[model samples]
Target: MSSTGPLQPLTEGGVKHAIVGTLEQITIALAITVPLGLACAVFLNEVPGGYARFVRTIVEAMTALPSIVAGLFIYATVILILGLEKSGFAAALALSVMMLPIIIRAADVVIRLVPSSLREASYALGAGQWRTVWTVVLPTARSGLTTAVILGTARGIGETSPVLLTAGFTAGLNTNPLSGPQTSLPLATFSLVGSPQPALIARGFGAAALLLALVVLLFVLARAIGGRGPGELSRGQQHRRVLASQRDVVRMSARRPVPEPAAPDPADS
Candidate 1:
């Protein structure tokens, strides 16, 4: 091998492609999982009765499922039934299944945190159940929705076994998830650690660091973007709050009696 070969381990082009492919897989998985998970959370939180309980039970059980089992299920259903080859898309779909329960649970907890008073106020204004939920409940819990998405993405990015069983690690660039083999950081690390080369081993550590950095960066970005900054609101709310404060001040001012002239005290001027 050329001296340059070890310097630029795993084909500089290959490493770049791997990073891109892994990002694509994670994005796709989150795209599917987030909406589905949010909907599940909404349903579970809003609907009453045994049916909702049953659905929640099913979702909770799914959270405990092994990653390999999810991978095998996808391998059987998508790959085998449809005769699709191993691909990043299939792997992302499997990872989305794995992430769904976590997203749903996180979202559900946040939705539940919404105060009952908010719902009462919405109803008092003649808003329907769905409208109240969409407008008031979700806006109140936007931070949690973002957090759930981050959790799902973190779980999806580092999953090795499922991606291995579905998306085989290939060296070349694969932009098309539907057709070509895709390499991820997890796959790269696994491959390098299994090899005997010291340089390759070091590269694996670099890859791990890169993955960790991506997760942390995404979490910070999500939190930054998730909610309205503190106290920022529509003009109406601001006006109402200002009015309430003024009314309180006026009420306190009116209630205070003029201090009667104090009786003359010794040595007072």
Candidate 2:
């Protein structure tokens, strides 16, 4: 790998920095987005509050949020205002913002598609609202949720503008995303392909191809993992559920009241 950032010769430059940077950024971004998105989706689907409509509208608008604006927002608030350096972490924040709405909106639609009958059955069994949502609603929407997550990943992974604005280019690998500049595959590809040299252009295309392959691989893996029908648990999940039920039984047994000894058969005495 070249020691110089994005200015090294085609012979000296390596893709390792870009690969590591891309993975780090996406990992951080997904970590930030997924839980929040799912919570928001659940709220929108389960609650019919007036504020929910406003939140839904905001999410819908954000789904169309421009990449440059995302970049600019981070650049202004994070880099400029917060005094953080241009680094992978900053870029990840921008990516998370771009991804959050897509995931929330998609997941909300998927959860809404779940049958009302399942929820009714759950309630009839004396399950609480949260319990029904946890055990019934989410499981039924598993495949669609997976698809939603994959769609958000696909959207954020290929973004060059955010990375460029926040993650300053680096030729050498930077493992610590908390500090220092980083370069993602898309940013590297954009830089290389813009050069007049045919070799750099070809390398850029190769990087692009690799990125495409990674995205497709992620989609396939997600589909395989989430392919089961509604309420169908994997063996591991079944085992855990069994263990949980056993614990519940033990707990109830411990809480059972002792019967008072029969003191009143004294008529015979």
Candidate 3:
């Protein structure tokens, strides 16, 4: 974090800038990749037509594609042809390209794991194919979908070559990812570890450690979000559930059918 050099003063290089830049790039990349990946997966699994196999083959091929190639593709198109400067946004685009296939493949598998009975029931109840996929299918496989997203995130976040090619190098902090050069933790670690200085090398290791911890934290969060039973809820969610039930009772009580008083028998009268 300090502006000081990787000099002899035992300067500790913090990854604050790298962390922020990574978050910015990843946030943008996820925003692009998640919806598109999910849609592609849905199309592949639920709506597989004549061309579905071709698309699936392409996604499978892209899964094994080299990261440097994605970076070069972005560099040639966005930078060389479109006249965009080296920025974190461009790096994020490259990351998106890398992440998209992983997400689509993982999500495709997850969506395919949905029980055929569920779709049959949904269609029997007058639901369309797309609606059934959107409502019943997606929710049922949400935990798996979250896992797929985590996989994609793991693939994108640790990538140094793509980030290095597009994001450029920066020592100081830069918050605006769309405008200027930015740095990610992996890139910072790569840059620092290559230096001849011991202090810089140590900082590089520290940055690498930080990146590992961040990935672990993300996995924990994903598990927390996705590892729930179908009818389970957190304490707060449970409280809300009760509150909603009470409100529903109140709202529906007036519509409840009232039993009429027993009619008197003629002899009793």
Higher-ranked by TM-score: 2 or 3? 3
Root-mean-square deviation of every model: 7.6, 7.3, 3.6
lDDT tens readout by residue for model 1, 168-191 = 877667889888788888888787
Say which candidate scores most in TM-score. 3
* TM per candidate: 0.79, 0.80, 0.83
For model 2, how does the per-residue alpha-carbon lDDT over 62-171 read when each residue is reduced to its tens digit? 98889999999999999999999999999999999899998998889889888899999999999999999999999888888888898889889999898899999876
**Which regions of candidate 3 are displaced past 4 Å?**
8-13, 220-269
Model 1 residue 22 CA deviation (Å) reads 1.1
lDDT of each: 0.83, 0.88, 0.89
Q: Going through the candidates in order, what is the number of backbone clashes in each?
A: 0, 0, 0
Estimate, for each residue in 99-218, the C-alpha lDDT of model 3 and write its tens digit: 999999988988877888889999999999889987899988887888889888988999998998999999989999899899999999999999998888988899999999988887
Model 2: how far is 265 from its true place, Å? 47
Q: Which of the two candidates, 1 or 3, achieves a greater lDDT against the reference?
A: 3
